[model samples]
Target: MEIQLKLYGSSKILSEKETLDIQLPNNSDIKKLRDILTKIISEKYSRSDLENLPKTAAFFSEKDEVIDDSYKLSNKEYISIIPPIGGG
Candidate 1:
């Protein structure tokens, strides 16, 4: 299965495109996605600012609703990654 991750905020660092395609096994959940992201970062962008993104970011469905770590992902689904925001 593949997920089209629409990049937002700091997540944009993951790729040069507006969206990043992530391949996963069938029936994989958001938790698995996070694990995969961690590996990607460690392997490719170890010193980049995305190190904590997988653990702190929030995911949204095509309908723009929040989805948790246990949410099941379907093939070719368009999801959005919302990186955490900091404020004064």
Candidate 2:
């Protein structure tokens, strides 16, 4: 199943890309998605960098409403992960 992913904030810096089209096994869960993303980010940034990223990660449905990360996503679903904004 193919899914749309959008990364923001420091996560974007780590990914070196704002968005991506990832294909995961059918019925993949949030945990699986997290693992996949972690690996992708780790490839660019150190594991410590990813781990230090704010915990403001979130998942939204097609309607743009906030949904639990564990919420099931369907094929072609669009997921946007907006990390917390930091300032001086």
Candidate 3:
């Protein structure tokens, strides 16, 4: 299955790109996607850089609804990874 990843805020900065398209096995879950993302980031940058990723970053579906790590991703689903917003 192919998933479209949309990066925002710090995720965009850290990933060095605004968007990415990744291929995974069928019935993959959010946790697997997260692991793949970590691997990709670690390969492009470093393990330490992966640590720099915001812990509060959220994963949303194409509908802009937040989904849990156990959620199974469908083929061609659009997933958005948005870092926590901060303001005073």
Find the candidate with the highest lDDT and give its number: 1
Clashes of 3: 0
Give the TM-score comparing model 3 with the true structure, all chains together.
Answer: 0.80
lDDT accuracy of residue 33 in candidate 3: 84
TM-score of 1: 0.93
Candidate 1 lDDT tens digits, 48-82:
57888999999999999999989999999999998
Local accuracy of candidate 2 as per-residue lDDT tens digits, 1-88: 9888887666676555777777788988766777777766666656675664434476656687877757777899888876665679
RMSD of each: 1.5, 2.8, 2.3
Worst 10 residues of 3 by lDDT: 47-56
lDDT of every model, 2 decimals: 0.93, 0.71, 0.78
In candidate 2, residue 54 scores what lDDT? 34
Model 1, CA-based lDDT: 0.93
In candidate 3 the C-alpha lDDT for residue 27 amounts to 98
Order candidates by lDDT, high to low.
1, 3, 2
TM-score of each: 0.93, 0.71, 0.80
Which pairs, if any, clash in model 1? none
- Regions of model 1 farther than 4 Å from truth: 86-88
